[model samples]
Target: MHRLAPLVFPAAGTRHTATVIFAHGLGDSGHGWAAFVENWRRRQRLDEVKFVLPHAPEIPITVNMGYKMPGWYDIAALGLSAGQLRENEDEAGLLESREYFQKLVQQEIDSGISADRIVLGGYSQGGAVALFTGLTSLVKLAGIVGMSTYLPLSLKLESTYIPKPASANVNAQTPIIMCHGTADPVLPYQLASMSRDHLVKLGYPVEWKEYAGMPHTVLPEELDDVEDFLRKVLPPSADGKTEL
Candidate 1:
């Protein structure tokens, strides 16, 4: 259960005001998205925001025929239908990964980053973890971002798994943006929309973005939207100690 060191990009500015911890999809490492951080740096944006990209540990993937790969959790099955995707979910794996993400967030807070100034985000399987963690976080966060992903452990939301009490949920009012593609071949469009609908039913406000003719991948336009979200949640602070 050892984790690989995360790929961290220090804030370009002298002041470290905010943080975004983004996770990669299954079979991908933190290095897979290094260019994203570099791209924002090239534009001189989010210069005061530190980016932390954590690498998921290698584990046996059932969908890949037990092949070892970088994954946040084990997928028992993969299908074009959303129902098929939720079958035999690895709950233990999901919780373990959630704990790991929580630890990373705590490290940032310990380093003086306000809890409300930190965002938890990811893609695909990583996104699932982010959603789960953000929903169940003890501390309030600035926002949550999920790209081309669906909610995990959806069935347990009303159960003891998620603590049904309103006071127990710190992220109930946190901003969440979920982006999905209509033509996704891996995770169907229905999954994203249904997940959003379910969250709305549970009284969570979600900002959903749909892309036309896009697949299970990130587009430049998607990045632009994400950049805007980051700016909205993590605005520039005159002093690095600004608390939201």
Candidate 2:
């Protein structure tokens, strides 16, 4: 499959021992979230951790009257009300994106970063992909983050979704943080909460956070919590070891 090279932020510290790959939402590119890494660096946090921001492929979005945009997959429709997002999902597109993300993770592993030191995350449509990919990943990851998003192809997770061995659910115990806003109009808050509930029911340790009156956008407090979460999951290597 064809893919665009992701925007990479090299570790500011002397060595790179860990990595965080974050994806952007629909209509946005990797550049959209580059400031996230800058914010951490400004505070002298995660200086040894490299950040990979992957741009989603530009495709026609059905809900936007078929206009092409940077999206992980095609969204059939979206509404303020809950319960409609589960239908008409693009399964093939989702699987393709999952494969792309999995390859990115493998590249990190091949470069000497342990799978346990890599965290996968994303926002909105991208978040949905991260959640799906992390859950089905064969290699155990350090953590997973989903901001203002929900899980897709949720109904078929058990039967036809996950590949063999991965069906073993290697990252079942991996930490997962999901953040959402109560006033989100694109993907309703209820949808996100339901996705959280389903994952929890499936034995995943998912920490749910909600911001009152906030919309589809992120908030300062939300990023603060996410930063704190990253600190906990991808802390400095206890042995002070460096991959490169």
Candidate 3:
């Protein structure tokens, strides 16, 4: 697999072992979540955790009338005005994205980090892709953390996702944490719930949380939840499993 240039944020003391690759939302750079990441870095004392943020390549967005933007895939229409905005299904683009991030995961594994110690996470559009890729991952990741995100390729997941023999039944393994705002205007709450339910019906380990009155953004409480999740998934050290 080729290399992907990602914004690297090492542990509090330059320690490296655990890995977390976080993608940014549409039209936003990988650094878009810098401040949010800083909050977690300061609050958590994970000296061995390494954070990777990958910037999305610029692409034409259908909803924006083919205007170029940094998006994982083209959005056909927002359907907001007519309540019919829908993501443009780009099979090639989505598959390309999955390959790119999959390399990042393999990179960490090749560098001595165990597959189970690597976490995949993102926000909004990034979160959606993370779910799409992480769920279909051949290697079992520590967990998947998606905020304001929904499952993509719902119809194709079962058939397209190539799983390892050990992961033939992914429903019971590979825990997932999905958070959304009940009052979200961009990605409606119902859609998020539907995505969660879809996974639940498929028997995936999915945890859905709703934030009251929140919009298409993250809240402090939501950040807290993410931090809590990270702590629970990654061990503090190779031999130490205390606070993370």
TM-score of each: 0.95, 0.95, 0.89
Regions more than 4 Å wrong, model 1:
242-244
Candidate 2 regions off by >4 Å?
80-82, 162-167
What lDDT is obtained when candidate 3 is compared to the true structure? 0.80
Q: Write the per-residue lDDT of candidate 1 for residues 1-244, one digit (tens) a residue.
A: 8788999998877778899999999999999999988998778778789999999999999989999999999987765566666667888999999999999999999988999999999999999999999988889999999999999989886574565577878788899999999999888889999999998888887989999999999999999999999988998886666333
lDDT of 3 by residue, 93-171 (tens): 7788888889999998887888888999999889988998888887778999999977777777777664646446442
Best by lDDT: 1
lDDT string for model 2 (1-244, tens) is: 4457999998878889899999999999999998877998788788778999999888889988999878899988877344566668888899999999999999999988999999999999999999999988889999999999998888888666554665577787999999999999988888899899989997889999999999999899999999989989999887757645
Name the better of 2 and 3 by TM-score. Answer: 2
Better of 1 and 2 by lDDT: 1
Top candidate, metric TM-score? 1
* Weakest lDDT window of 10 consecutive positions for candidate 2: 78-87
- State how far residue 216 of model 1 sits from its true place (Å): 0.8
**Local distance difference test scores for all models:** 0.89, 0.89, 0.80
